[model samples]
Target: MQPLILHIPHASTHIPFKDGYLVGEELLQQEINKLTDWYTDDLFDSPEDITIKADFSRIFCDVERFVDDQQEVMAQYGMGMLYTHTDAGQRMREVNPTLRKQIKEEYYLPHHQKLEVAVKKQLDQFGHALMVDCHSFTDIPFERDLNKKVPRPDINIGTDPFHTSQTLQDLTLEFFTSRGFSVGLNWPYSGTMVPMAYYQKNRQVQSILIEVNRKLYLDAVTCTRNRHFNEIKSVLNQYLHLIRSNVNDIFYPINNES
Candidate 1:
């Protein structure tokens, strides 16, 4: 069986360049604090799993967004692949065509390239790849969020119709629910990450998004790890193992000749 690929896209806080940003250091840090998927790189860590993480902060470039603004829904809110505005609708960056292109070349494209290469290697070796798009979300809804309803679930599983199978979905729900987590299916966020090369075209490239509610392991106010951080990480490690052991059953089930 192939090792699981963990796609961690928003855990970094590094701002590569400040050329286009309109916000001051203090304000930018505040946004970073709120937007960054704190400790996700560590939260989803597993010994045997392959991880492709974005080195720059999402404030610099969001690897998760679609390259074209026309295809991204969040583009309407100024939070596309390269965010120009903050969650509160304030203009945070002046993204001219040249700057946009530069940022894409400098940050966005390279990250996706890494993802594509990783997935390709897996497919070449095992004929299939399962990418777990790891993420964490704030318990409180953001100003630009599609869902503003209070009291969000502890765990949210985002699925792709073409890439996420029925069996995969059921197994995911069972895994978290059995652990006593309040799970939601695409409640606050929806959709999983797949490389453009394989998206909708390759059934062998399966993907799912696991968004943990930050309240479970983060101190929202201070943006620090809470007492439950290690506990949460332990659970995620178990989840990785669960996927590994059941890889064949989930992706390539055997059919008995009846």
Candidate 2:
């Protein structure tokens, strides 16, 4: 088996509210459901791969954002590592510098650390690691989104020039496009995830961010899986198998057999 890491960062809905920090549990639940990737973890999960998922909601701690505000594009909207605004531009919670530091040390750092450890293990074992960041977005835009007016495609593939090569990008695009899904290079969202320590240093780590349109498999209003869920899941399973079959060539070409 080749080294593959399935990174599911936003499927969780659990929020630690015992500190009496949140306003209302009901509203929090709704917000979480709206912001979450829904059933993405289940959609991309493979029994043969190593999967690392966040245990809490992004509202509490977004492990995907760059730790530094200046480096994170979404920081301008107050949705950086620690979110201070809601999807509608309202105050989600007041997290001061001290509190933000606490959240990062407790949740953010550890989560990324887990990913780092996984990637390093893969690197040691196979000389490279393929990190597939799985996600799902609502068909319609949220109120505070910068590109709210723009239409989102069925599948948005986020890439990094350093980690995502043309071959991998083309293959991924073709795979989903051939499946009848409207694919976008980067529309509503862009960029891929890499561990902080290896951000610009490691070319052995290949990253791809996949954003599935919620309309494809979800009941938008109720936030539940629809009939299309199984079909999409099967499609994802096929893609995972394809990746496993071609891992060396697609990701680690240096190791490809002559």
Candidate 3:
């Protein structure tokens, strides 16, 4: 089995249950349309890699946010684990303690458990694991986005100081830049996903976040694939193949010692 875990967190638009929502169905749908990372699951799909995707929409519960609001930077804007406000700072949901706890138990915890299990399985089998946190961001900045820079790069590579080796970083840059795509190193968004169990504790479990610009593959307004979609998908597939082929060289001394 490949020692890779693909984490696609915000791809779904399904809302299992609707409670505490302040907006009507029409408004809620609009928010979902705006926030959902459309087609990311399909874009990052790889039969060889283990994929852990959230079944529900991020508007319901964002698994990426830190469980505790205090630890999450976005929480201050009311866009934490359970979003209470929309990108425009509009009240979207009424998240009381009970509802927060319920969502945590129902959605947040279970999703994380799956990630932990996948990482552990890879480590046990291969002595090293690589997590590719796959995501696509809007070319236009959201109202609440910290960075307001226009003309975003084609790709954003998020990394952790310890988990992302210099070699891996260089290879990722080369892979994208060589194809004539502009790249950003932790620019608009930052940080790769690591299961809490091994986060900052294990170097063998490596991770890198690949955020593709929506303009590259989608018509952002319509939320549909554009002319470049297929070409972008093909390029991403090649990227996955590149990483898999160089797994040994990327992991290096760890595999050597093993």
Tell me the deviation in Å of residue 42 in model 3. Answer: 0.9
Q: What is candidate 1's lDDT per residue for 1-258, written digit by digit as tens?
A: 569999999999998879988989888998999999999999998879899999999999999898899999999999998889988889999999998899898789999999999999999998889999999998899999999877999999999988887778888999999999999898889999999999998888889999999999999989999999999999989888888888777776412211
List model 2 lDDT by residue over 1-258, tens digit each.
884799999998887642424457676677888899998889997999899999988878899988889998888887898877667776667767888788889999999999999999988988888888899888889876766645679888999988876767878898998988888787787888889778878778888898889999999888889999999999988877877677767764534422
Q: Which candidate is the best by lDDT?
A: 1
Off by over 4 Å in 2: 18-22, 252-258
Clashes of 1: 0
lDDT of 3: 0.89
Candidate 1 segments exceeding 4 Å error: 253-258
Q: After superposition, how far is residue 188 of candidate 3 from its true place, in Å?
A: 0.9
Instruction: Give all TM-scores, in the order shown.
Output: 0.97, 0.93, 0.96
Could you tell which candidate, 1 or 2, scores higher by lDDT? 1
User: Lowest-scoring 10 consecutive residues by lDDT in candidate 1?
Assistant: 249-258
- Report each candidate's C-alpha RMSD, comma-separated, in the order given: 2.0, 2.3, 1.5
State candidate 1's TM-score.
0.97
